[model samples]
Target: MQIIVVGIGGVGGYFGGRLALTDHRVEFVARGTHGKAIRENGLEVKSIDGDFRAFPYKVHETLDTIDAPDLVLVCTKSWQLEEVAQQLAGRIKSNTLVLPLQNGVESVEKLTGHLDPGQVLGGLCKVISKIDGPGIIDHFAFHPQVIFGEVNGERTERAIALEGVFRSAGIDVILSDDIQLAVWRKFLFICMISGMGAITRQEIGVMRADEHIRALMETSGKEILELAKHKGVGLTEKDLENAFRAIDAQKYHSTASVQRDLMAGRPSELHDFNGYVVREAEKYGVEVPVNAFIYYCLRPMEAKSRAHE
Candidate 1:
């Protein structure tokens, strides 16, 4: 299989490294220092699953350098998805599958706006990881899993084939029948965690342990659930329970990539998480005070960081 991973950050580097382990041709698309490092030293992944060095078939900074791929993983941050999709629009073949391992629920919509709708898949991943440094991905927590499916819930041959490829690389992959719920469930977890972690500047273990912060997290989650309901996304109380379960299971020092970025004064996915929820809540006439408070409180830092970028 000819695969293109568009962003060699945490999600891309680790999973793309796993895919590169196969005999298939997995080309990476990274930029700046990270791209240069990979071209010079190959991609090293420090994973709880296992550590390995992956030399992809090639490392190209831009998609135009590459031809059509059997699969394209848009592993960029939530904010970069639309730009990545636009770049991919011209390169992908008719049969190419474009799967976004992004954090938010709007990825399929964003990709479909730029690429072939049939080619876009609704997807989300479970992994606590980030770039430890240039060319290095540290998968320090959680058992990584990739859950994806066709946007309309069809059991397509291509989806099955792609699932097989992940399984071949020992990734815990799933072909979901209801990908919207899956995406929403994952969003519910990450949005609450990222917002709480960013606002409080605390780790998941700490926040989950503190009664007041735990209440904040729960209220924020409830707001998101109401917003999801207003938007016609099926998110249940059990899904909320699962989200809290994940928080409980996280490593003591685990913090989301968005939280880390906000803390470090770097550009982050604030708009993709709480900001998105707040906007959508306004649109749908749903009250999301907790999410709005989180977004408004942290948005100034986000703007400053982006201005620096």
Candidate 2:
């Protein structure tokens, strides 16, 4: 398959690097110093699973220079999704698959608004990783995995084919029958901790250890659960329990990418994570006061970061 990994950050770098090891043709879309470094010295992945490198590989800064791909793995930040999707408008074939490995649940909705709905897939990933340096990705925690499927829940041939390819690359992948539910389950966990982490400027361990913070986190999660219920997503109480368990299972020093981005004053997924919840809650007439408080508290910083960007 001719694959285009659009954004060689942690998720894309690790998974795309593994896919490049296969016989399929793989190209990466990166920008600025990172793209320059990858084109100059190749892409490097420092992973807990194993270390590997993909040199002499194709790297492009824009879609204009690349061919229409059979598969496009979008790893851009949530706020960048619409812009990226617009760029991909005429850059993919009719049957091309676009899977967004972002944290939020609205990726498919956002993409469909820009491109053909048939081209977009519901997807999310589990991993704690980052760009340690230009052209270098660090997978620091979690057993990396991806879950994706058709929006309509059909077990199509394309989904099966992608699953086979991912498996062949030694990737832990789940082809879900209900991809939206999977996305929300992950969202419930991420939304619960990410906003709180950003507000507190602390790691998961620190937040979980504080009674006040823990209570706030639980309330934020329940707010999300209420919103999900209104949206008709199949998120359950058991899913919320599992989400908390997942948070507890993380490394003490573990922090979400959103929190780190906010601390560094970089643009983050704040609008998509907590901000999205707040907006949806208002739309559905659901009360999400905790989520609203966290989002409002961080809105100024988020706006400042985006302004500079």
TM-score of each: 0.98, 0.98
| Residue-by-residue lDDT tens digits, candidate 1, 11-124 | 898899999999989999998999999999999999877899999999998888989899998899888888888888878899999999998888988888888898888898
Candidate-wise lDDT, in order? 0.90, 0.92
> What tens-digit string does per-residue lDDT give for candidate 2 at 224-274?
888988999978889888988998999999999889998999999999999
RMSD (CA, Å), each prediction: 1.0, 0.9
Colliding pairs, model 2: none
Evaluate residue 5 in candidate 2 and report its C-alpha lDDT on the 0 to 100 scale: 93
Runs with alpha carbons beyond 4 Å of true place in candidate 1: none
Q: How many backbone clashes does candidate 2 have?
A: 0
- Best lDDT among the predictions, by candidate number: 2
Q: How badly does each model clash, as a count of residue pairs?
A: 0, 0
**Deviation (Å) of 148 in candidate 1:** 0.5
Distance from true position, residue 83, model 2, in Å? 0.9
